[model samples]
Structures are given as structure tokens and as C-alpha cells.
Target: MKVELYDTTLRDGAQSEYISFTVKDKLRIAKKLDELGIHYIEGGFPGSNPKDAEFFSRVKEIEFDNSKIVAFGSTRHAKVKAEDDMNLRSLVDSGTDYVTIFGKSWDMHVRDALKILPEENLSMITDSIEYLREHGIKVFFDAEHFFDGYINNKEYAMKTLRAAEEAKASCLILCDTNGGALPFNILEVLNEVKGKIKTALGIHAHNDSDAGVANSVIAVRAGATQVHGTINGYGERCGNANLCSVIPNIKLKLHINCISDNQLKKLTEVSKLVAELANMSHLHNMPYVGRSAFAHKGGVHIDAVLKNPLTYEHIKPELVGNERRFLISDLSGKSNILAKAKELGLKLGKGSPEVKVILDQLKEMEKQGYQFEGAEASFELLLMRTLGLVKKFFVLDGFRIIVDTHYEELTSEGTIKVRVGNRYEHTAAEGNGPVNALDNALRKALEKFYPSLRDVYLTDYKVRVLDTTEGTGAKVRVLIESTDGKDSWSTVGVSENIIEASLKALIDSIEYKLHRTRGQ
Candidate 1:
């Protein structure tokens, strides 16, 4: 059977410690989820905050192609009737056809948190569903702490589900609310109550026990037709089961068609987009959509992948909009060098002397604290220089920087002279700091000959102290990442003097930018 995908990103994802999506963010994310072919999106509770209320109001302008919006709320209070409860009334006001209502299934919560009898909690469940059904809303019932309740009191838990099923809930979602249940526990409980109720079952898992994805996939194996989760697993208390992982496991591993082939190819792009909107860095090692997911580094593994990717990869990365990557490192062999050389448009054989020379230089530089794993531009430049294929755009004559401070304010100036094709150019510029001044002065001297440098700008600059024991005079490694609008590259430099290290990386970046202007 084709399983249903229910995403609670806007609702549960906002509960993550560092995640706070604005109304605009919710709309954009909801739109992305729709385009990616999700079936349901749980928008936040409108009654809880003005932001969510505004989101529901603004989202009406958007016409989704694939997803239906869902509003979330709890069961009616024990003392208040369903029609009189404000939270239930708000669910209807949210202007959604589908709604999810969570009710206490564990007797412990009923006796302690709700301070009510078990029968009263069941009535709350029935009343909430019945009220929403009467209002033309499709209700999805979340049995909060269902697994825990089943373990402590199987008969009571089963009774709660039967109440919702009889009350006409569209789907019964079993929630691992505390997020401590294991796969074995889920399977054990599910086996005991497989056909006790006629309602269709859904699984809502959490990651505190690190089995959310596993439990979700297993629930499908046990005959569930729907899975509830959030994108990137963002939620409270270790987050929910990651739909990024769960969807692929269902469609690719379990031989189920939960999502379309075209939708599967957009997974990586959507994952990165969501991370960007969340103001969080895309996790490098996240399954299916991470930068390091298909990266091969070891010598044997690199050779094997070049020959047959199936030896190291579970599936072709293109299936999920990701690509295979070969990492350059000390552990790399001739295969790695040859692969990188080919990627840079150079042809080299396994026994080529240039390969050994480049490998030796790479290892020596790594030992000197110059890392090329993230600095591929520097590695490419090294290959060109070693092969006598490098072009000298300009020859640096000399440069100097001066800094002075008055009160809390500071001023820095850099002067540089260069010979571009034997023509001399000298320039001076002031900046907020030494590095900035140097960059400004260098471009001032060279932009006349290489105007493409005008488009090149530093996007990221990082410095790592390689020898902390030396303290003030410790050697530092500087990595500078530059972009020319169309492409970006990283270069590295190592020196005890921070300014010198920065200058070295800056020069390499400029050279790379000039090379990019060429069709080569």
C-alpha cells in the first residue's frame, strides 16, 4: 500500500530549541512541502499565538498543488463541553479541512496531569472528534503517550482508540510523546493489538531513543498506512522522526511507493532549503541529503567507487538529487589524484610521476597545517603549478600594512605594488582592518588588468590556531572562500603571522577568480 506522509514541521518543528519560524517562513516552508508532494501539513495552533493566526490568515492566498493544511489542538477539557471549548472552536476557525486533536491515552497523565478519571478522558476524545465531524472537518486523532499507556494499561488504551474510531476519526495516530519507546517495545505492543480495532493506524515517533525512523518504518511493516513526522526531524526533546530518512526507507527499502520518483530527486534541494530558512547550517552528515553522505576518501574505496559505485554506495546519489564526491586527503591514493585531476579537466594515468609529486606535496602541506580537504582551489592551483601549466596574471613586487589606534577607534592602511604583464601599478587604500585594507589595495592595483576581480568577493574567512600551546605566537591556518556569483572556491594558507596567512589565501582566491573568467 502507498503510505501517507503527514508533516508537522510548522507546528512541532517550531518547538525545537533554536527554531522559530516567522509567519513568512511558515508560508514558504509550507509551499515547499506542497511542491515536494507531501499529503498533509500541520500548521500551528491558531489560538496559541498571533503569529500562527496570521499565518493561517495569510496562507489562504496560496493555492497548494499537493498538500492539504491541517490545524492542531487538544481534546475538549473534562469540565467544558466540546462545543463550548475555545481551543476546539479555534480549530474550526483556522480555516482548514483537516485537524489533528491529541488526547491523553495514558492513565498516568489522566490521573496526574489532567486530574480526571479514565472514563472522562475517553469522553473528551469522543466529544472532540464528534464535534469536528459535525463541522465538516476531517479529524486525525493523536493518542498521546499511546505506547506507554498500552504497556501500563492495554485495556484502557485500546478503549481510548475504539472511542475515536467509533466517533469517526479519519486516522488514529499512535504517538510516542515522551520519545523513550524502542522498536522492540513498539513491535511487541502492536503485535498484541493488530486487529482489535477497525480504525486505520498511523505512527508518530520521536528521536530521544534514536529509533524514531526505525520505529516508523517498522510500523508500516506491521500494516500502518500513514506516518507522522517533521522535516529534518526538528521538534522538542530530541526532535521527531526525520521524514527525510523515513520517506526513502519506505519507497526505496520497503518497496512501497509513498512518494514519486521526481519528488525523490528534489529531497536534497528541499532539505538544504529548509535548513537555510531555519537559519541553521545544513548538516553535513544527514542521510540522503548531506554533503558527506556519498563522499569517498580511502584509497581502496575511491578505486572501487570509480570502478563500481555499488561497492561503496547504497544507491545512486542522483536518485535523491545528491552527487558522489571524492575527498582529497593523506589517506588518498593515485586513484584519488587521478579522479581529482579528471574533475579539473586534466588526464593522468595511475603510474604518472606527476600524480606522486602532487600526492607528496599534498601530504607535506597537510603536515604543515595547510588542509586542502575544504580548499580544493588551492589543490587545483598546486596541480597547475606542479605541471608548469600555471599562468602568471601578475607578479607581486611588495606590500606593507600599517595600523594605528586613537581611543577605541582604529585605522588600517595597506600599500601594494604589482607588475601586470610588465606594466607597473601601485596603490594604497584604508579599511576597517588590515585584511580588508590589503584586499582593497590589491584589487585597486589589479582590477584595471583583471576586471573580473571586481565581481569576486570573499564570502567566508576562517582561522584555526594549529598550535594552541604556543599561545600568542602559535601558528594559524587561514581558509578563505571566494565567490564570483557563478562559482565559489576555497584556498588555504598557514603561517605564524595571521596577516601573512590571510594575504596568501587572498592571492590564491584572486588567481582562481581570474581563471574562472576563462571558459576553461
Candidate 2:
């Protein structure tokens, strides 16, 4: 079966906390979505904000081959004509051939929100859809709060959909705006509506009940032709249905055609790109595209997957542009080490002395609170050292940090000394914190020897207490993620002193970059 994918990332997704996209960001994202084979891209509500209005005006310059640009808005006001409604007028002026207008379906919303009679609400829906159709725009009517409306007053909800159908709406999208409806409820309501409405059916689901994807799938099974959602499930509150999960489920599990298999391979990249652009940390546990989605840690699961990946993985990770990871942990076995070695292009046979040695070292380091799962760079460095393939780029001589408080103002300063090749360098710098000061001083000293170090910078730093029972002096583990704009890597360190831990991780980060660059 053919199903249409409608993405509202620019519209509903912008309502998420801390998700503010510039006009350039929106246009870039829309193009990316189009490249991924989405059928429709809801640019934004053009009348709601100046940025969205400007986005609609600027989006016309780019050519989208597969996806159609859609302007989103609400129906005409009950008190005014459709032509006079500013929101409705903006949709027409957006210059898009497609428009989505949501209308109240529940009688309670009509009386309380719109402050109009139920009949007037029906008239508004019909008039707005017909007016947009008259302007040579294909109309998709979103029945907002549809599940709740159907439960409260089935007759009025049916009437609202009938009004849209009578106005020649291309699709009637049933929206679960509150996102509290269950899959069974969605199936039941959509089945009843499918029998009543002659127009094409669509679904717009939210994740408030954590069943948005399930509900959307059920609606599709119940004959919804178009599925509306956002990439990475980004939206207000819990979020909208996650297209990353929904699209694959509909195509692979349901045996339906959504996008080509080649397009599916770009899923992970697209998901991460959206999260990066949104300035949010990607969820490691997210279903298909997460970093840890196919990670194997336990010995039993690792051995089984090594023998045959189908024993543990539901689908091949490569199908979604992700790779299976054999995480090095205390629970890992020799098979885990072999798999990781194979991935790093190391030749470690079964029952090799090096395998046991590496396993023992990993267990000891993990006991010391080194988490190799999140610090793959550290793990790779450790593997290279064990295989005698690593060379030290520099040696740390010593470091000192000093904090001074004068009158209520506080300042942190760091000094470092290091030997690069046959020469020695010393540097000092101040920063907002002890770690930052150390980072600045160390980078300042290293840049003299390695010019490429100027392009490298720390992107993220996290510290975790290994043993709280040891009180304030407990061992702390530091993980630092660094990037050189083109690529990124993670390194880890552990020590009783927080500053020492940070310094170790920082040193590893710089050494990793140098090693990769120099082909060491």
C-alpha cells in the first residue's frame, strides 16, 4: 500500500522547548526532509509569527522535487468571512499550492474556544476549505481534538468532517491533539469515520500518552492514507508521533511502500541532524537511529549476536544507516573483544592471549569507573596500545590550578608544562572554571607544535561519581566529546581528583586527534 508522509517539524515541532529554528535552519531542514522522500512539508503557520511569514516568502526560491510545501493555519473565524480572516488570507498568500487548515470538531471547543454555535463551526470549516480550493490550492482539513470530539459528541464530529468533504478537501486528517487516545480507540473511531466519509483519510497523532506511534500505525491499518508526524518525535509536551519509527514500521512491518530502501538508509543521519540542529541531546535509547539502539553488552547476547546477529537484533542495523556495536563492559566476553577488534581492523583470533589481556584490562578499568560504551575513542586508544600500534604524541610534565576570590569576584587560573618531541613548552590561562582553564592552557601549549590543534575544541563534558559511599573524595569519571567541525570523537578519564580526571580526558582527546591526523 502507498502511504503519504506529512512532516510538521517546522510547524508543530517549533513549539517544543528550546527548539527555535532560524529561517535558514527551517529551509535547510525542509530540503533535507524532501531529500528523505517526505510527501509534504508543513513550512509553518505563516500568520503566527514574523519568522514563519518570512520563511514562507523565502522558501519559494528553493526547488523541492518530491515534497510539496504546505502552509498551515486555522479555519476562518466564526465572526468573519473566510477572505477577511488574516490567518486564512496568509495561507493563500504563502504561494504554496497546498494548505492545511485545522478546525474545531468538538462542540465544547466551538462554544468555549471559538465562542460560536456548532453549526457556525461547520460553516467556518466548509467556507475556509472551499475558499482555499477556489484559490487553486489543495486543502487538507485537520479535525483538531478529533478523538476527544468523537467521544464527546459523535454527531457533531461527523458533521465537521462532512463539511470538509462537501468542500472538496483532498484529505480529512483526524488529529489526536491531546494525544491521550489509545490505539484501540483510534482504530474504532477511524473505522467508523472511514465508513462515513468518502474523502481520503489521514492521521495526525501526538505522544502525550506515549502511544502516538502505535496509534498512527493502527490508524493506517484502519485505512489512513497519510500519516502526519515530526522527525525525532519533536513537538510540544511529549511530542508528535515519531516519523523515524513510524515510517519504518509502516513500510517493513506492515509490508507497505513508503520510501525506497535507499532512502531508509539515511534515517539515522537525518535523525541526528535534526537533533543537532535543535540543540538537543539525542536519546540513546531511541528505537532505530539511536547510538545504543543496536549495542550489545551482556555476554550471552553478545555471543549469540556474534554467532548470528538475527538472534538479538530485530533488523540489520545497516538497514537504517546504523551499525551494531559490541560494547566493552564488565559483562563482556572474549567474543565481544573479538567483534570490537574486527570492527577496528585488528586481527585478534579466538582464544588469543591478547583477547584475554584486553578483557582483563577492560574489566579493571570499568571497575575504576571507565565507561567504554560512551567513550569509544578511549576504547580504541586502549586497543591500539595493547596491540603495540600507538605512539605517544606528547608527554605531560605537570599542571597546577589556582583559584582566587577577591571581594565577591572569583577567578580560576591554570598552568601547564608539556614536552612535544625534543622541545618543552609551558603556558598559563584563565577560564570560567578549573576544567576550562586547564583546557585553554593545554591547547595553547599544544597549538605551537600542532597547527591542526587550532581546529579542535571540546563540544561536551560530563562527570559522574563512581562511588558516593566514599564521600566527597570519591573517584570521578570524566567523558569529553570533542569535534574538529568535520568530525567528532569521545574520550574518557577517571581519577580521585576531578581536575585530574578532566585533564586525563582532555589529553586523550588531543592525542586521539593527533593520532588520526598523523596516521600513527
Q: Candidate 1 — which pairs collide? A: none
**Per-residue CA lDDT of candidate 2, range 146-264, in tens?**
99999999999999999999999999999999999999999999989999899999999999999999999999999999999999999999999999999889988997879889889
> After TM-score superposition, what is the CA distance of residue 249 in candidate 1 from its true location, in Å?
1.0
lDDT of each: 0.90, 0.93
lDDT of 1 by residue, 1-520 (tens): 8699999989998899899998999999999999888999998998799999998899889999999999999999889999999999999999899999999889999999999999999999999999999999999999999999999998899999999999999999999998999998888777766778777889999999999999999888887888999888899989999998998889899989888999999889888888888888789899988999999889899999999999999999998889998889888789999988888889899888999999999899888888888898988899888998878888889999999887878999999999987699999999879998998899888998887788878888899999999998999999999888888899988999999999999999888777666512
Q: What are the models' TM-scores? A: 0.95, 0.97
In terms of TM-score, which candidate is strongest?
Answer: 2
RMSD of 1: 1.9
Badly placed stretches (over 4 Å) of model 2 are 406-408
Candidate 2's clash total is 0
| Residue-level error in angstroms, candidate 2, position 281 | 1.2
